[model samples]
Target: MTYELYYWSGIQGRGEYVRLALEAAGAPYRDVAREDGDRVLSAFGKGIETPSFAPPFLKDGAVVVGQVAAILLYLGDRLELAPKDERLRLWTHQIQLTIADFVVEGHDVHHPIGAGQYYEDQKPEALRRAEEFRNERVPKFLDWFETILERNPAGPDHLVGDRLTYADLSLFQVMSGLSYAFPRLMERLYGDYPKIAAVSAAVAKHPPIAAYLKSDRRLAPNEEDIFRHYPELDP
Candidate 1:
């Protein structure tokens, strides 16, 4: 049976994380909102005993899962995007959770005041927030990823085991989003994080992902998305 992925129609937000894993695994899935459009807003406050609390939730048969990491966790074993060893599988989930933290930080740069306010409304605070993100947070997050890749006994080719896991695809998505959101900053810092750069490059070159990127299915990052770029903030 094909899986159902529910997320906003436009913008490659958190949904891209799950999409990458599904694409790499060659899993059949329907991007629910993209097809019917109304299902997303309709899904809210309706259906299932437990509320998703947000979009980017996945539905497989009677099972419904939300949160990027949790959805990926549920899909990992089924899609072969996790290691057989339980410890490594949990480790991958840990990395993915950290990635989620990093993603929130990225989003806050533009919405420092609140998600309810416009970036223009929070421009001053966003500038301050972005300063910390660009200087302190980006390096901190990238450094951790570099260290994890180096420490992986299997090799730097993957995050958890020798094979590509949802964590790896998530990392690649982060790198891609970060690059689009901070091109100048990444160009300056990419040299210091060779392992992360290598992983991003390799993930991009993977046949399934490469084709997905070329296909109409892949949504482009934009101002409406989490990783929005304001030129002043980029500097």
Candidate 2:
């Protein structure tokens, strides 16, 4: 069965995480909103039995899964992107949740005051937040991922197990977004986290993921997206 994904058009946003997993697994899925913009609003307006709080929801037959981590968890088992061992599987989910937290923090750097308010309106606050995020939070999150890779009993090639998992894919996306959002900060800090860098490189080289990155389906990062790059913000 072809999976149906509902997310806002244009920006990659949180939807990209789910897209990366589906692409890595070579799953056949339809980007519903991309095909029909109105479909997202229609589905969201008319509530399903299990309505999602927002976009980036997935439709598989009758089952509707919401939230990036939840969607990946649901897809991981079926797509073989998750580990078979229950303990390792939960560990992978934990990693994805942490990544989700990192994404939110990264976004908050630009919109520190409120999501509804414009970045220009909160420029002063955003500048302060961005400095803290760049100096403290970025290294903190990257350090944890580096330790996870260094401690993985299997190897450092992947995040969870010897084989590829959704956690690794999600990490790659996070790294990519971070690099785009804060090229200067990452250029200086990324080298220190060689294991995290290795995972990002490996995921980019993965055949399916490589193809997806090159395809038109992959949207470029922009100021409007969660990972926005402002010259002042980065400086």
Candidate 1: TM-score?
A: 0.98
Alpha-carbon deviation at 75 in model 2, angstroms: 0.5
Tens-digit lDDT track for model 1 on 1-235? 9999998889899999999999999999999989989566565548669678887889899888989999999999999999989899899999999999999999999998899988889999999989999999999999999999999998999888798899989999999999999999999998999999889889999999999999999987899999977788887
Question: Alpha-carbon error at 233 in model 2, in Å?
Answer: 1.0
**In candidate 1, residue 225 scores what lDDT?**
97
The list of candidate 1 runs beyond 4 A from truth reads: 44-47
All candidates' TM-scores? 0.98, 0.98
* Tens digit per residue, CA lDDT, model 2, 1-235: 9999888888899999999989998899999989988466465647568888887899999899999999999999999999999999999999999999999999999999999999999999999999899999999999999998999999899998899999999999999999999999999897799999998999999999999999999998988899988989888
What lDDT score goes with residue 32 in model 1? 90
Q: State residue 98's C-alpha deviation in candidate 2, in Å.
A: 0.4
What's model 2's lDDT at 193?
96
